[model samples]
Target: MLWLAFHFRALSLEVFSRGAAAPAPLVVVEKQGSRTWVIACNDAAEACGVHVGMAASAAQALADGLVVRRRDPSAERESLAGLAVWAGRFTPSVSLAPPDGLLLEISTCLSLHRGLGKLLKQARSGVTEMGYAATMACAPSSHGAWLLAKAEIEKAIREPARLGSLLAALPVALLDQPPAVVEGLERVGARTLGECLRLPRAGVARRFGQALIDELDRALGRVPETRAFFEPPASFERALELPAPVQAAEALLFAARRLLPELEGFLSLRQAGVQELELACRHERRDPTIVKLGFVKPTRDAGRMQLLLRETLGRTRLPAPVHTIVLRAPLVLPLSASSGDLFQARNGEADGDLLLERLRIRLGKDAVHGIESAADHRPERAWRPCQEQNHAAAAANRHRPLWLLPQPLPCHDGRLQLKSGPERIESGWWDGGDVARDYYVAEDRNGAQLWVYCDRVSGEWFVHGVFA
Candidate 1:
């Protein structure tokens, strides 16, 4: 199987933000024996003479206003697992390469994503979008891809035969061998894999142990390697903490965009779409501000979702600075692929649903609604407003006017010229409000058509509706 590997090079510092630029010169340090050493540093810190592997004390002395944070292995693992979930949109077979790497078996998925080149382009951009700096490489074997990515080679090796020659020059220290074996190999002038590979195989295996030989065989695609693949989570719920508190809606959206892509990936994997989303903005001392977004139909388009979210945020007023944001899409329904762009322009129809959704987000839920025909014969109780329109049935009478008046106005039929015969609507006797009328189509001198009905009981004529 063709394996693609992603080595998260800056994971030591990036777990805090993936790969977001820090506001100041920052470094992530870890304890090495009794002294703390910088495991990762940003360009800002590097410009101030602070580099990875430098002692924390020396790095602090070299840079002014430097921020030093301890490396969080737990966060790094969690971030890697989250990335595996995100990568599920590309390939189903994903395996975690612990500390800072991942392996994806993509032989069956290359054509599904167009090609290797296009797939790699999308993968690179996806990693960047998730705020991670990763080196990617492809090979015939999982360990081969992982080793190449760790060495920062960043090239796709198609043939298994070429893997040995390509991996030869890489440092022996890059291997997953024990420290003592690596030290022993280095002591014997075998600093690179090529040098160690040229040595007597039996002598090396007998001295260094068979595990190293087996590891080399795996990397070279000579032996089969079995790795547990990552299984995507059943539901999509993620939280991201900001580097600093943000009060503006735009800043909040900027952070929220990162989560949208992952949500899209999750939905894409499930072949479903989400109709609602809940965004919770966490504050230090106040309750989280919950912003609920809705759609006219289920959708998986990240771009469209972001557009509506931006419109919604414009009208929302945050009560306090938000320290963290959580995005949740608990329920997803099966959606046909053709329905993904259902809200888009169709048959030259205006984007009315989008307009309605935007208006509901801007105004209020109770302000904008649709109308449905109720089961009543009385003109006043014939229709009612509803949140969702029921298109199963329409008014039984086809001659009803599009525009109906709220209350019928009493008028004289002497000045009106009757056109159509009277249509009787004598139902609703079971209720207190009953209408016993014969509706007729009439025309005035202004050439406007009107709906006028004569009460059978009072013999009084009234204008009820106007035809558009």
Candidate 2:
């Protein structure tokens, strides 16, 4: 079996720094009694000599304009769980690796992705797009891949025979052991895995206990490894709190873009598409300004969805400063495969759907509507306005005029030429209005086709519509 490990080095800092305007010198601090200490630092913070375990006050003094945030274990865990769900798109057997890592069992699905190299490239690119920098490694054993990823060794050791040689070269400190065991190993001149392995097994077991031996055995593939794979949640509701309040609605788009990829990944894993979603802009003092987005077709494409969202946001006027944005997809439908006709010319149905989606967002949903066939048989009441339309169903079985008048107009001139025979209409008795007429396709004096009908009871003609 092949195992892929992703190690997010500075998860806490990365999670908080996602939508920041500039890469500032930021550090995550933990409160210890009365003193606060640095737990994680970004690249800018590290460059200015801010290291983990350093006092927060000392670090701030060393670097000007340093940003310090308290470490949130819950946020870090939530981020890790979200990443695990995102990784489920690549493989079914995905497991969370604690504070900032993931393990994916991908051996069974390697051929489907062509090979390991392409799969790794896609996974790394996807992770980067989701606003996180990760180091990845692949190995025969799960723990071995985790160690390699932590060490930033981008190697794929699939062969069991090569696992020993490669893992032995890694430092003994990379093993998942107690601090005392690691210190004792270092004091005994066993600074690397190879040195520790060279010592007699019985003596090492007696000194380090059975747990250390089991850990080593697991990493080296001497025993079987089992993990509880992560399961994605049924519904998606992701919210991002901005670093600062956004006054303009358009300004929120930058933060919203970061959430789109995660949504896309979630939909991909579920093999579903969303028809409607709601974006709630949380205000500081007022109620949240909500923008409801409806799509003409169910879609999972992030780029198309973002384009529609930008158009909607461009026209929105914020009531107050927004501190947080929550995106929720309330309606998700199964996505079906579609294929185009090879023999005929391409139809612009997809393009038309996109245009309708954009128009619905730019204008109000009530303002933009589609024409659908109604149950009434009368020409004026035969169709109704709806949000979604089926063009194929509307065009079926009968020919109708391009334009219909609000009420039938009396035809005074008797010199009209008839092109088609009369079609009888005898319905509408169930309602209050009753109509019994013989409709005919007639041409007027100007050579325009007019839809005229003769009233069966009065024997009078009226023009109802015109053909384009």
Candidate 3:
């Protein structure tokens, strides 16, 4: 089995710094007994002479505007699991390596992704888009791939015969063995895997115990290794915490843009589209401010989603500065796959409705309405307002006027001359409001076309609509 491993080297710092989401000079610290030490630092912090293992006080003394944050194990794990779901878009067999690593069995599915080169390119680009730094490596064994990733040796050692030689040069400290075992190997002049392998197998196993030999065997693929695959949730809901409170609703899109692509990946794997979404912004003392978005039709396009969100946020007013934002898509519907023609042309009408959708968000859902024909033949009751876009064609037999007045205006035949013959419309007898009239298209003296109908019951003529 070929395993591809991704080791997020700066996950601890990224969990808080959040790249452009919070691009401040930051350092993540941890407490060892009494003294706190820096565990991770971003590039901005590094430029200020802030390095890992330095005392937190020393780090602050060196950097003038550095932001100090403590390491959060829970957030790291959540971030890793979220990435695993994103990785599901590329392959199905994904295994979690806690404390920042992911193992993907891509040997069986490389062809599906257009071979290894394109798959790796997409995976690396995706990690960057999610605002994290990661190192990736592939090998014949899971342990070997993981070790190579951790060591920052970015290469794919596909053959089992080459894995041993490449793993031999790696230090013993990169192994999963206990500190005591690593120290024991170092003290005995076995600093590298190659040096340790040169020692007598019986003596080495007896000295460091069988676990060390087993680890080595697993890395070399001499023994079988079992892994439990990661399973993503049915729905999508991810939260992002900003380092600083943001007052402007539009400015929050910088961080929010990261989650959208991930959401697109999730929906793509499920072959579904989301119709409604909820963007909840959290404040200090007040409840979360929810800004809901609706679509005319189901869609999983991230670009379209982002566009609608930007328009909605522009009109939204924030009650307080938001510290956290959560994106939720609860309603998912099946979206069938559609292939473009050879020229890659898309339907123009669907694109035209995007403007309507944007206007609907900016104004209000109730403000905008589509119209469709009704069953009644009366000019006033011929059509009705619809809440959503209806593809059904308007049912019509004879010519009808679009600009119908609310009540027919009384007019004299002397001022108007009839141009077309009478077209009778006499339907709607079951209800109380039944009508029997002979409608005619007429031209006014000033050349304005009018739709006049002769009332059969009243023996009078009235103008209902203008054809202009």
Report the number of the highest-lDDT candidate: 3
Error of 3 at 313 (Å): 1.4
RMSD of each: 3.3, 3.5, 3.8
Off by over 4 Å in 1: 18-22, 61-64, 342-352, 378-380, 389-398, 401-403, 409-422, 440-468
> What residue runs in model 3 are displaced by over 4 Å at the alpha carbon?
19-22, 338-345, 389-423, 429-432, 438-468
Model 2 regions more than 4 Å off = 21-23, 32-34, 43-54, 62-64, 111-114, 337-349, 389-392, 402-417, 429-432, 442-450, 455-463, 466-468
Query: Which should have the higher TM-score, number 1 or number 2?
Result: 2
Backbone collision tally, model 2: 0
lDDT order of candidates, top first: 3, 1, 2
- The residue-level lDDT of candidate 3 at 265 comes to 67
Compared with the true structure, all predictions reach lDDT values of 0.84, 0.84, 0.85
Clash pairs of candidate 2? none
Q: Supply candidate 3's per-residue lDDT for 398.
A: 48
lDDT tens digits, residue span 91-132, model 1? 878899898899999999999899999999999998877787
- Candidate 3 or 2, higher TM-score: 2
Write model 2 residue lDDT over 1-468, tens digit each, in one string: 999999998888877777555557988999999999999888888999999999999999999989888988888888888788677667879999998899999999899789999999889887876678999999999998999899899889899879888889999899889999999999999999889989888999999888878888888889999889988888988887665677665667777777777777688788787889888999977999998788777777777778888888888888888888888999998776562211111576657777888877766678888888888888888898876743545564334696899899999999899999689998888877999999999988889888899999899999999888
Residue 359 C-alpha lDDT in model 1: 87
Q: Which residue pairs clash within candidate 1?
A: 18-131, 19-131
TM-score of 1: 0.87
